[model samples]
Target: MNAQSAADPSAVNRFLKSVVAWSALFLVIVLLAGLVDPRYLDPQHKQFLFLLGFIGMWRYSNAFMHYCRGMYFLYWKYPRMRKQADKLGDQALPSEIYMVVTSFRIPSHTTYRVYRSVFEEAARVGVPVTVIVSIVERSDEVLIKDILRRHIPDGAQVKLVIVRARGTGKRDGLAHAFRALSRQMPADDAVVGVVDGDTKLLPGCVANAVKFFKLLPTVGGITTNEFCEVEGSELIRQWHALRFAQRHVNMCSMAVSKRVLTMTGRLSFFRSKILIDPLFISDVEADHLDHWRLGRFQFLTGDDKSSWFSLMRAGWDTFYAPDSNTLTVEHPPEKNFFKATRQLMFRWYGNSLRQNIRTTKLLGYERLGLFTSYVLYDQRVSMWTCLLGLTVSLVASIIYGAQYIIIYFLWVAISRTIMTLAYAFSGHSINPMYPLVLYYNQVAGSAMKVYALFNMNKQSWTRQKTTLDSGSGRFDAVLNQVSSKIMLFSSLCIFFGAVSVLIHLTQRAY
Candidate 1:
């Protein structure tokens, strides 16, 4: 079915929800700025005014991008465009296309059984398959060995890599595997496919991916569409599904059209030679260490981003195989707020910072379409616009009375409502309730950006250990703060505008 048919709506509800959310958000920002300083109109208060405005505008910029992207999807992406990708059939099966599945946290028995089944599928297709489980916990090593012995096919090359951590965190574990794998494999042993252990590969995923890699020499790697196996309770999982769909079905394709800036981490492949290249990883062994080691620069946090950026820098093309599918279990946020927020903060901040660093470096590189708009755009207005809005509203409200402030807010609310509805109705297949999600996404993001900005110096390399229960608390805090701040800012704006009008009236009366 085409995406257009799927986007049936609950538009009235969406519009109303957007009005409430946007109004509340604006109000908080204005009120908070006013409480901080009622005299923002004074010339001496310029720095203070700029600070509040900067925060509001930064939040606004983030929302505007997502809004624009949603609009892009509405007009361009529905299932009609999806049909084109469907036409590219999987062909030319290769016997030597080895599938490598990597796992870090799965229980030993489950890990073994998954590969046992996977090996069977590969053998059916006539290609050798290998499963590499990074034994994160020493206790899990025995279970991994058991899986290797029982599930590994007679002819398939099953390699068990044990990551003995002399150091702390996920970075060490991944670094250990990367360094070891680089030494063990050569450049020409066919493209190496990497998948998370939990991923259930579609029967011909490996075979079809081989066909894709063969189509272009510049094709550095490919990733498959992911669907969640676990469901229920946590709405965050659904958000992920939506995010996954947008990226795999849309952004990746767009990235390919414009030369990919970076590749996704989930289920990616690389030319084997790229791994062994002197430029990719160093030749030195960790002197009798069981696991190989690479410098932090060669092995960085957010491994997937590192690979994507490296591939681009090395002048290789990358693309996503949206039709090729991998279903994996989804871990959703618990109903708790902190757990969710913390997880998001870590993931968003960590990825953003790493990518920010990568983009800055790329500005000097010989890559096209890699320019970052945020870095280039002058935000002079952003530094004071919200504050200015607040001052004008407050002054106008006092002179003309509160009706003026209320009227202006109503206009702002109405504008947002219209945009939300227009965005939803314009062919994007997002669920009608997506605007609520969209609203929350913006408010939550503003809180995140605020936190990340303050704590930017305290960056951590280790990906946080997250489960459903742990993230809710953090997210709740963010949601509350965002809601409050936006409301506060809007109130302050009305106050300033009212005051301005009142001063003019008093001068005329005098």
Candidate 2:
């Protein structure tokens, strides 16, 4: 079984209730539109549908091309590099390493497992590694200490340092721990690792991942592939599995260019020269983005993006391990699946968009390389394009009749199936529900990205329940919320209006 099937027996064994209800509503609307119209087969309407179809095709075609390109690197190029690293064995590893594991509001059992795995890897690597444990509780510190003592190999130079943070959030916690980690004065050639509290390192994960840094002198940072252990329904597990599978392909694609968008915070390693620098450490601790409306608000999440931005500006290349090397324990912040997923996407995409704006202006095609810059630019436009199929189809459905809607749904089903089947080439197990899930991810994810793009300063932590203070009065907060909604709603109206004009349906002739 591949990493995908290992997540659960298939949360998608049953269909989504939302899908059923949506289909019912759509059928009802289609019927109404059909009954009210008699020109569903008009040639002008046909011309409009044909023209609008191209936009949907354009967006999906780009994705298909990316998948094909990504598959070539993932299955072909990456394996060659992996075999070369495997042959080098321990020779490819750093001389000495420092790993900082932050444990804040994470379950104690998970904290123990994470530390134990880190210690075991240290012992296996047989290197002198100093682990800095950042914790908010005394119990986890004591627990990690016990784990370290038990896993230290005989005669191995395994050292541990514990730092307590103010517990404001992960960014603050990492700043506290990293400042201490820098104080240890690791060697100039050493490697520095950052591990989140909920992520566990797999066996030999450190050696496997860190070796890439030694192999590629240009690489300044490396993050490993991840599989999630989700605490939710089978559907959620499958969603996580599908997401990881997609991430693996995307990472491999970006790695070939030596520039991944984000070096994941769950488990990633950096060159000591970069992380140990005081300025670099400070960026991860309390980074802020300047925006026109959001103003200059400090980041409350996405420490990972901050690290990647610093690397980009400093001219350091970043990529990922060719192997799956970590397991993230996922707990949905809410019980309702839709609410939980939206919350997660808000934070995840919000990070990318927040950093995306700065990077767009900071590093253009000249510095960021050709394809990398294009991908970043696509991140800005893809949200609008993603909504085109549904938006155009729904508009046409309401006018030209249900036939248009039916035909649009057929295209969506067929297109998404082709997209999901392409994952088979990615070497991950394929699920029957993947096509449906992929559609949901695109539509819902695009919606979430649009919202996050507008509300960039709305940052928060799920486990910590921490948010950006804003430091504004209650009335000011209400006004800001109203302004955000108006902007989002107005932009969407403009988008729909543009589509209506393109289809020549502005006159609403039937």
- Give the per-residue lDDT of model 1 (tens digit) for 95-204: 34444455556655555555655555555555444444444566666765665567655666544555564434444444455666665654464566666566666676
Candidate 1: deviation at residue 81, Å? Answer: 13
**TM-score, per-candidate, Cα-based:** 0.59, 0.88
Question: Which ranges of candidate 1 are over 4 A from the true structure?
Answer: 1-95, 98-102, 105-125, 144-167, 187-189, 229-232, 282-300, 332-335, 370-433, 460-510
Write the residue-wise lDDT of candidate 2 on 1-510 in tens digits: 456645655533333543564466456545644544445546656556566667767786777767876877777888899888888987887889888888888888887788888888777777899888888888887888788777776677888898998788888888887788778887877998899888888987888788887678888999888878888987787788789889888888888888988889899999988887878888988799887775678999999899999998898998877574789988889888788888999999999999989898878888898888888889989999888878877876786566767766666666666666678777666665676778889899999999998898899998899889987789877877888899999999998888878657534443
Of candidate 2, the 10-residue stretch with the lowest lDDT total is 9-18
lDDT of each: 0.50, 0.81
| Candidate closest to the true structure, highest TM-score | 2
Tell me the TM-score of model 1.
0.59
- Best lDDT goes to which candidate? 2
Q: Assess candidate 2 and give its lDDT.
A: 0.81
Full-model lDDT, candidate 1: 0.50
